[model samples]
Target chain A: MPQIAQLAATYSSQIFWMLLTFGFVFFVIGLGMVPKVQSTVDARDKKIADDLDAAKASSAAADALEADWRAKENAARSDAQARLAAAKADAAKDREARLAAADAAIGEKLAAAEAQIEAGRGKALGEIEAVAAEAATDIVRRLAGAEVSSDAALQAVKAVI
Target chain B: MHQFTIEPMFGTDHWAIGGYNIAFTNSAMWMVLAAVVIWAFVALGMKRQLVPGRWQMAVETMTGFIDNLLSANVGPEGKKFVPYVFSLFMFILCANLLGLLPLGVIGSHAFTFTSHFTATGVLAILSFSIVLIVGFARHGFHFFSLFVPHGTPGWLLWLIPVIELVSFLVRPFSLGLRLFVAMMAGHILLEVLSSFVINSANAGPGWGLMIGVPSFLLMIGISALELLVAVIQAYVFALLTSLYINDAVNLH
Candidate 1:
């Protein structure tokens, strides 16, 4: 083959040019340019990680704030409930005391009215007895045409009239 | 044979150095072309954008591929050898693919430099030299232990080391010969089938219809296969080199 035949003549030239060209590739491109690309990739990765960490930190902070607000809201709600219950109890006690005082006043006024009616009835009965006695004495004296005493007529009215 | 012939571009007698014919040849031209192509490809992709465009991505992918290969094969220390392996891989890959370019349709021949033993042998020797240097530099005389597998019985120690030494020595030859033969054979097969197509058509219409058409079809199929082979050979070369470096670095 020509490859074998021409080996002694051309190998040096091939190797020489190959090394020169390949040397440029290795030194200039591989060493110089590749690191720049790799560093860019590295920087992007670091930025992404940092952004994620910041997001997580902010989310945690927000959660803590929400939890703190909820705790304060719960405390205030319980505090208002306690105050409302206390006021209701105080109002109920006051109403009961007032009702008891009003009941006592009404009982005292009704007893006084009953006592006044009882005294007036007794006085009216005594007057009616005197009028009847006088009438009896007049009748006795006119019918028999005899003298009749007023005290004796009152006694007869008290006994039978 | 004519396609494989290396014609000195500037006449053989005019470019001798130290009694060696150092005239620039077609193989040298292709090597320089491959280098230029690689340089342009890498230089154009150096935009350094955080979000790489397609061209930048393509360049990054090539370098990253070699980096990962070394990382996997030779471990962390393999990082130091990335530039060399990247250069080697790109050079061979470009040479192989460039050779297969259909430039013949435009009356210009593409020389496949990797098809020559001299070129591939030098590449193989370069990889082998690095292995030897790294082995000795890292492990001193213990690098010789590479020829001896662990847990060998005393009786088999002599025999095993001999076999291992032979295999180790054969690595460069095997590496160089594998690429050279594959590239050379594919080109030769394509050329031979092309000749058959031309010769049969000239002989008669019936022979052209029977042999020429089928040979032409087979040539097309083989040409496609050759493209795949070109890529595979470059990958295999880089892979084996890294694995050999792995042995040197890890001492196993």
Candidate 2:
């Protein structure tokens, strides 16, 4: 009963101080501490996000560089292979030209050797015919003791020899 | 037993306004002390780190717990009331624990303001007033519909509103009473048990050990429980405030 009874007189003073304190706490804490703490948290989170983004970007750049290098290496290899194949084809062409020229020179030499042999054989056969005609005229005069013409003897020897 | 008395901390002939006992009494001084202590606690604990330390973790946990309670009860709009609820919870919590200190009760110095109905009642009234003002402001005349239950018989509707009105009016008393009674009862129990331990120990050495041990153990257990009660009462005060505000905003 005294508790209820005292409340009438006591409430005003209690309330005045209560209001002052409670209001002080509300304004100071709500406006002051809450926002400060929140900003710190947000700043920390932002830094983390920025670091993560940078890491991802650098990794992607590295991957792209590796890919470009591989492509360049492949291109250079193909270029070397093409040059090698062209050199091989040129060498084959040069060898075939040299062989054809050698074949033509051998054919010309064979024809010249056959022509000289034919001329020498013709001269030797003419001398042999003249000797045979002389011999034939002498043999006819000795065997029959009859006079035979040199021109007729030579003609007969040319026909037989 | 004498610890619950209200007396002026300083001389009687000091500051008084208009014959009112505005003299800085034990109650008012403790209220200020509690405020200062809480202020130091939260203000100093505001050191922000990505991974919180012990003090920051405690502060953040308390704030986050209150925030979750508000969101659950009052939805997002309750966020605006965080400072008020924070002040109320911390102030009451500090006051309750300060009263349990080793300070003598001759002047009732450091008496918990929450143990007095006047202080707790003011908080209840403030919360109730917000509920009324917000309910009416948001819903206009339709706020009266709060007492009207849905799917009632037309004849019984009149009786239901009367009951509802009484129930609604009882909220402030119940809110204040719950905090005051819990704190006062816990302190009274501790006082009684501690006195018992002292009295038994003085009876005789042999009998003192027989009875005093149990009494001392009980007192220790009760003190631990009281500590738990202190935290719980603060939580309940804020939770009820949020619930009332929730009803005002969301209806039902």
Candidate 3:
């Protein structure tokens, strides 16, 4: 249509500026902000990965230390048990030696006392026999006259024994 | 038919500023009215209510329609440029639709046609720049290689520049022409058909009714066609612009 032709004819002059504006904005976005966006995403990803690695390493170290601590505790417990058994054995030996020494002393004292009582009993028996003989001789002398005293003593001794 | 032609005004009384003709023009008045209408639509669209009203629907339809269309065509990449594309589409659409409006101010005062020429020129320049800038922004100097393409024979290199230059140069021409032509055609058709109604009305009553009804119907159809054409032209203009920029910025 002629109207279209007129429209086209009218707008011919504006083409240059329009083209320029498009070119300018194109350069601004392409060369400027795109790289920044990419780098930011990259940096964030790297930081997250680093943190995860650090956490894993620390936990591994902690686990290793815990294992070591358990081993040491096991060794200490065994050593303590051995020491306690040795101490108990030494205490039993010492008690037995002390009890044996005390029993020996008691036996020696009893034996000495028993031997002394036997010797005293023997001496006292001999004296008592002698005295009985004398008394009996005296009694016979008083009852029967002088010459018959010997025979009387013998008979009195036999009766007294 | 009325005399319809475009010639630059040049005379003692004709004012010229910076080598561009300065004259009161029909295109200028139409563009002003279009601007007012668009502004009103924008204001109405932004009434900021939870529920969208009719005026807001009108604005959203244009924006959402373009958004969906681009998303469908170019995927996410098209969505990034929706605002710019929508604004550009709206401007072009308004220019096209304004031509359908009756061309008298206060029912009598006729505007100068020089203003219309400048406004269309400005729009063409704007759309051309958007394509250029958008492509370059996306691809940088790499955009320039898009014109050269890939896998061409050494002998074809000469043809490449020629084709590229012609295509690039034609960008603004197509944009400006598409809107101007559609608007101009719709207005002319409506004028002719309505003139028949006016003339036939003076004839016998049946004659008037006979022509009037058909003319009215034709006008309505043409008006609808104009609406469709207006949106199509704007889309074509922007699309070609983007395609050209894509050519300019892409690498093989």
Report the number of the highest-lDDT candidate: 1
Error of 3 at A65 (Å): 41
Answer with 2 or 3, whichever has the higher TM-score.
Answer: 2
**Best model per TM-score:** 1
Tens-digit lDDT string for candidate 3 (B127-162): 577667776777887676766766868999989967
lDDT of 1 by residue, B126-237 (tens): 8999999999999999999998888888999979999999999999999999999999999999999999999999999999999999999999999999999999999999
Model 3: lDDT of residue A139: 67
Q: By TM-score, rank the candidates, best first.
A: 1, 2, 3
Question: Which candidate number maximizes DockQ?
Answer: 1
Write one digit per residue (lDDT tens) for candidate 2, span B111-199.
Answer: 77788887788888888998899999999999888899777789998699999889999999999999999998988888787777788
On DockQ, who's better, 1 or 2? 1
Give me the displacement of residue B138 in model 3, in angstroms. Answer: 5.4
State each model's CA lDDT, in order.
Answer: 0.88, 0.80, 0.59
lDDT of 2 at A18: 76
TM-score of each: 0.83, 0.71, 0.49
- Ranked by DockQ from best down, the candidates are 1, 2, 3
* lDDT for position B208 in model 1: 100
